[model samples]
Target: MTEEEPRLSAREMIERLDSSLSPGRRVRAVAALLAGLAGAVFVAALWWTEPGPLPGRTHLAFALFTVFCLAWSGYGGWLLTRRVPLFATDRVIAAWIGLAASLTTTTVLAVVAAQRDTGLGGTLLVGGLFAGMALVLAVRARTRRAALLRRVRELTGQEDR
Candidate 1:
């Protein structure tokens, strides 16, 4: 492992230098891209095709939903086009963003259900599932980021409390 001695074989070096994502990540990227794009388009179409003018709150809700879907599409497209792997910091940020989106969407849905005198229980149940998943992802992402930071500190011999 000395500087004078080669550490990686030719194939290993080439693989490390390759820019493409792994198969699983590629699948995720494509799924995210398609799902987000479809969701955005559907929401936008519904909003546009409504027969009557909506209230200010309804308009805002539609806009928010559209933006959320667009954000996901943009993130997927960015990941697909990037040359480098997503780093720990990026993952942490993404996880937090997801958590926020989940919470916001859940709250909005719950409010709408209550206002419409619909099945609030069903709405909360579904929204809670998504929010819980997002929370789990956020926690996992933070843990992973911390572990990576600790490993880097160990390798550099610069441990800090």
Candidate 2:
């Protein structure tokens, strides 16, 4: 469309003024590619490090890392397909941060279990602390996400969905 043509959407206007038509798509595609490649490399590292040998603390650490990479890869794939707008990326980022925090806590606990004896009291304490923090973060993220959606609706001149 030419400059004289009226763009009906924020996306279209942005694309017209800017150089890219699908900026969000581009960002998501890059993330997906990088995450997928990282996942594959981590899987390979898992095989190389363990090699079906005796499982040790170090192997457990590597396994945790591999799982993290795979999870991120899947997340990236979901993001890529979701087609989130630039303004909405903040909400997505907030959600991802919360998810990463919880995943880290879980992975750390798993690694700890792999390293030493599984103690109920100690595990429960640490788990409870992190779980509470995760809950707080999740609630905050939801608030931010709602605010972001409201802002998007305002910009788009659309009714609340």
Candidate 3:
């Protein structure tokens, strides 16, 4: 009599899905927490230290930064937890490009505002926060992809070849 291969139980399937989703979800959660904390800190520091009144332009810039951070962190967290394929190569690349542009433009604007009055530390703090988030997302996506590919290869008995 021929032996049949054992089938995966439902629990095993669920576990696999959880494993695939966990890394990305963790990354997103961390990113969100960092962003929120950083945003609060930036606002507090700006309120305390900035000499002159906050310029309208600076306020606008801060608003933009706040929106971007909240959107990215919230959406990214949702996508990761749901195991959505939102981080395809093209999408990831596009996101990184956007991050770069936002960071650069915000920094420039902040610097200009600071030159007008020496007390705006908000820009530096927020920039660092976003930079850290970008780094975390990039690393998590890359690692997850690599691990998935490796698992596929192992399952197919193609790794050594």
Tens-digit lDDT track of model 3 for 86-155: 3244245435645674576657767786877855687777777777777677766677666765665566
Off by over 4 Å in 1: 1-4, 7-19, 158-161
Stretches of model 3 off by over 4 angstroms after superposition: 6-19, 22-25, 33-53, 84-94, 97-161
lDDT of 2 by residue, 85-111 (tens): 444453456456546756565667765
TM-score per candidate, in order? 0.76, 0.47, 0.42
Better of 1 and 3 by TM-score: 1
User: Order the candidates by lDDT, highest first — what do you get?
Assistant: 1, 2, 3
Clashing pairs in 2: none
**Each candidate: RMSD:** 4.6, 6.4, 8.0
Model 1, residue 137: what's the lDDT? 88
Tens digits of per-residue lDDT for model 1, 7-37:
7754454447567888987787787778889
**Where's the lowest-lDDT run of ten residues in candidate 3?**
85-94
